[model samples]
Target: MIVVQNLIDAISLGSVYALAALGIGLIFSIMRLINFAHGELIMVGGFVIYALAGNPMLVMALSAIIVVTILALGMERLAFRPLRKASPPTLLIASFAVSYFVQHVILMIFGSRPMGVDFLSVLGESFEFAGLRVPRLQCIAIVVTLALMVGLVVFFRASRIGVQMRAAAEDFTMARLLGVKADRVIAVAFALSGILASFVSLYLVAQTGTVSYKMGVNMVLIAFVASVIGGMGSLTGAALGGFIVGIVSVSLQAYLPEELRPYRDAFVFLLFIAFLLWRPQGLLVRRASERV
Candidate 1:
């Protein structure tokens, strides 16, 4: 039962990371730029939820999604689109600039301290079934992750924009030459990423019961690593990498001595190194074609 419970917790955590990685992976697929500021979208959504606290649950959720999506679109238009033709390192630096700028802007408005938030209190509850205890949020997280993954698959397979996005991911210059609107596809990618960030915000606030400007930073970092481990441009690989990380993290916490628990992340990274040494191309390798 204890093992089962731990598995549930790990899966829930992985689901959250998987959602985050999918958001990052989608954008990287098209842009080849890792937006460190992606975390700010999650942070912004948290603040939106915090600001709208006590409103109807549905209202708060919709508002967060809308606001975050708009900001994501704005980020692409204002910060990234102009540099679309820049070198990879230049784009990376721009992402870092956007990350720091937004984080500080949030700090100025919300202050540096963490603020308690009671969004989705019910998800904090836990239950027992089949002799195993499980968190409601964990169950919901798993379900939501599965649904989103399925929905994305369907969207990519059926929708015209989705096909264009996939084509853009494969080879952006060719896709645009084939009449895929680069702006529309890239904008849609950011919008979708923002939507994912909002959900990440809700789950995080519910789990932590507090909102901090830096809350999304560590998660985004982990999600980025997960994306890399799974294969930079492979959404399915990113999801798998997230689960692998969650499982490894949870198992280390469970098995490590109390004195060594503080070094768990060091151990995780060590393992990551080992994994990379074994399969540097990642679990799912992207096509060899040039991105642009």
Candidate 2:
């Protein structure tokens, strides 16, 4: 029963990681650049929820998504779009600058203290299955993540805008020639990423019962590692990698010697290194010809 409980915990945690990683991977695949400020976007979503303390649950959720989505769109327009023609290194440096700027701006507004929401009332209560107990928030997170993933799959497969986005990711110039608005598609990708970040932040706050400006920093690292292990541009790979990392992390924390607990991250890093050495292209590779 303890093992079952641990597995459940790990799956819930992994679902959050997978959602975050999907966003990261989507933006990377589309724009061919990493958004270092992604974590701050998640932070912004949490802050939005915090600011709107007593609103209805639906209102709070929609506001969180909108705030982050607008922030992401604005970031692309002000920062990334201008640097689009620049070298990859230049764009990467700009991402770092944007990240720091957002972090400091958040500090100026909300200070460095942690904040939290009363989700118990909104999410209702917990329930038990067999000998294992599960929180309503966890179930919500899992269901929402799965739903979003399925929706994305359908969108990419059936929707015109999704086709354009996929085409843009495959070959920007060619997609442009084919009458796809590369810029618009990239912006939409960022918007979608922001939404994913908001969902991730929501569940993370529920799990931890609080939020900090720096909450997403470590999470971004973990998600990035998962993305790399899964396959940089492969959404499926990212999800698989997240579950693998979650299992490994939980197992290490639960079963490793006390002296080795602190080295859990190191062990994960070693695994990443091994994956890179063994398959630099990642465990699963999206063919160059494949758009998404």
Candidate 3:
């Protein structure tokens, strides 16, 4: 029973990380930019939820999604569009700059102290089925992640804009030459990323009951690690990497010797190093192609 519970916990945490990774991965797929500021999108969403604590859950959730989505589009247009032709290092720096700017803005407004949010308290409680206990949020997280994954798969396969996004990812210049609208595709990608970030923020706050300016820092870091481990530009790989990291992290916490537990992340990275040494291109390597 304990083992089962631990496994459920692992999946729940993995789902959260997977969502974060997917959000990062989607933008990377289109722009080849890591967008470290993606975390700020999550942070902003959390603050939105916190501010709307008096509102209905559905209303708060929708507002977060809308606000974050618009913010993401604004980020692309205002911060990144002008730098589109610049070097990758420049784009990377821009992402970091945006991240800091947003973090400080939130800090100035809300301070460094963590704000408590009592949203979704019922999900924190445990329930038993067939003599096994599980938190309601865990189950919901797993289901929601799976549904979103499936929905994305369908969207990519069946939607016109999705096809254009994939083409742009494969070769942005060529895709543009072939009549795909670069700005529109990139904007859509960022919007999707923001939506994902919103859900991640809500879930994180619900689980922790607190929101902080830097709350998204760890999540974005994990998302980056997952992207690298899964495959740099592959959304599926990013999600897979996130799950791997989440499961390993939880397993380490559960089974490591008490004294060594504090070093769990160190060990996780060591394993990541070993994995990279074995498969440097990642599990789902994107086809090597010249991007103009």
Candidate 4:
């Protein structure tokens, strides 16, 4: 039973990471650009929900989604569009600029102190069953992640836009040549990413019970690492990598000695290094051949 509870904890944590990683992977598939500012969208969504307190959960959630989606679209147009032809390094710097800019804006408005939101308090409730206890939030996290993942798979398989997205993922240049509107597709990708960020923020805020301006920094980092570990451009691999990261993270937290627990992140990186050395190309991405 102890082992079973641990497993549940790991999965619950992993599911959240997977959701964030999927959002990161979606944009990478189309644009080949890592939007470092992605977490800002999450933070923005959280703030929106925080500001609109006392509203129904459904209302706040929808508001967050709508506002973040608009911000994401604007980000693509203003920050990314002009740089479509620039070098990756240039785009990367731009992402950093956007991230810092958003962070400061939030700080200026919300101040340094974290704000509280209990809109989803029901999820914090826990129950015991089969000699084990679990929070309602944990179960919801797992279910939400599973449902979103399955829905994404189905969308990609059955929907027209989804097919275009997969095509872009496989070969953006060729797909564009075949008449895929690169800008439109990229915009759609960002919009989807924003929606995912909102969902991530919702779950994260519910679990942690507080929100701060820089709260998304760590999450975006984990999502980026998960993307790399899973394979740079493989959405499925990204999700897998998130699960790996989450399980390892929780396991370390659960079993590490009290003194060593503080350094668990360092230990997680060690495991990451070992995994990379074993499979540097990642779980699914093909290694590009060197050409003379």
Best by lDDT: 1
Q: Candidate 1, TM-score vs. the true structure? A: 0.97
Candidate 2 accuracy as TM-score? 0.93
lDDT of 2 by residue, 6-109 (tens): 89778877888888888888888876676778888888888887888788867877898899999999999999998888876787798889889998988999
TM-score per prediction, in order, is: 0.97, 0.93, 0.96, 0.96
What lDDT is reached at residue 248 by model 2? 79
- For residues 1-292, write the lDDT of model 3, one tens digit per residue: 8888788889989998999999988888877788999999999999999999988998988999999999999999999999987877899999999999999999999999998998888999888997788889888889999999999999888999999888887878788889999889888999999989988988988889999999999999999888889998899999999898999999999999999999999998999999999999888988532232
Candidate topping TM-score = 1
On lDDT, the stronger of 2 and 3 is: 3
lDDT, candidate 1, 1-292, per-residue tens: 7888788888988999999999889889999989899999999999999999999988888999999999999999999999998988999999999999999999999999999978889987888779887878888889989998999999999999999988888888898899999899999999999999989998998888899999889989999989989999898998998898898899999989999999999999999999889998899998732444
Instruction: Compose the digit string of candidate 4's lDDT tens values, residues 81-155.
Output: 999888778888998999999899999999999999876989888889999999999999899899989998998
Lowest summed lDDT across 10 adjacent residues in model 1 is found at 283-292
Q: Mark the regions of model 2 whose C-alpha exceeds 4 Å error after superposition.
A: 121-125, 288-292
> Candidate 3 clashing pairs?
none
lDDT of each: 0.90, 0.82, 0.90, 0.87
TM-score (C-alpha) between model 4 and the true structure: 0.96
